[model samples]
Structure formats: C-alpha cells, structure tokens
Target: MKTIRLFSVLLFALSLSSALSQAAKPATVSVNRIGDGPIITPELDQRMGGNIQGPSLIKVPKWIENPIGQYYLYFADHRGEYIRMAYA
Candidate 1:
C-alpha cells in the first residue's frame, strides 16, 4: 500500500512539472501579408532593429505610409510575407 502511494505521488509531481514547463513556454507570433512582391520600408527596418532575416511575421495595418517616402501600402493582420533587405 505504501509503495503504491509513493508511485502515485511521484507520477503526480512529474505531471505537474510538465504542465508548468509547457505553460512557461513563450508563444511565437507569425505575420501574414496580402499581395506579392517585396514589402520593404524604413519603418519596418527600424522596428526590426535594422536586421530583417530569418522567419518573420508581422501584422500590417491598412494605409501604411513609407518611412522614407510618401507612399502607402495596404496591409492586414494574419498575412504571411517575406522581406529581404539590408541596413547600412
């Protein structure tokens, strides 16, 4: 009876630990964009710390103005897009 109780306690502890670890994990945010071609702007580069590489996802708002020039692009959330640019 004592052995069974110990086993049960150990299993409970293990399960609790696993649940906590999973909860502590951070969530990854993905961005999606509508339309083709490149979406590069000074604002995006600034927001990304001037480094646009790897897998990036962003939610673009409608009527976005260019950070460098007077231009606008339609953007929305939950859209996947690719941005390849270099900062100098």
Candidate 2:
C-alpha cells in the first residue's frame, strides 16, 4: 500500500510538471474523407442479407497471407447463420 501510494503520488507529480511545462496550442489536424460512404453496403453487395453484425477487422500478420491492404474484415449477421470475410 505504501509503495503504491508513493508511486501514484510520483506519477501525479510527474504528469503535473509535464503538463505545466507544455504550452497549449491549437491542434493542426485535417479531416479528409477517404470516401463518402462505406465500401460495402447491402445495396451495393447483395450477397449479405439484413441485420449484419459482429464486424471484426484486423491487419494480417507478417506470417499470414497479406492482401492488397494487409487488412481484412470478418463479419456475421444477427442470426450468425453465415460468416463472411473481405480483404483489401
């Protein structure tokens, strides 16, 4: 408990000092839309039915077969009747 408290106090003091030392400035960030809408939609791709769910997107590992973008999406519908995947 004593060690944890001391660590916490030290962390808090360090963070406070760092925050005080840094000057506040406006963020120089821009929002550029890659696309107006989703790449795959029910209207565009009729393969999928309604109630699409469980979308898990991940980057392909170095060992695995990487696609053009090295990323893929695993998705299923609400009923989970079928699982579909798309790579880019």
lDDT of each residue in 1-87, candidate 2, tens digit only: 999999999999999999988968878976577979865566746768767887787878878763566888888878868888888
C-alpha lDDT (0 to 100) for residue 85 of candidate 2: 85
TM-score of every candidate? 0.28, 0.51
Clashing pairs in model 1? Answer: 31-57, 31-58, 31-79, 32-79, 32-80, 33-79, 33-80
What residue runs in model 1 are displaced by over 4 Å at the alpha carbon?
24-88
lDDT of 2 at 72: 86
lDDT of each: 0.53, 0.79
Report the C-alpha displacement of residue 37, candidate 1, in angstroms: 48
Q: Compute the lDDT for candidate 1.
A: 0.53
**Candidate 2: pairs in clash:** 69-88
Candidate 2 yields a Cα-based lDDT of 0.79
**Deviating ranges (above 4 Å) for candidate 2:** 1-33, 65-69
Given candidate 2, what's the lDDT at residue 4? 100
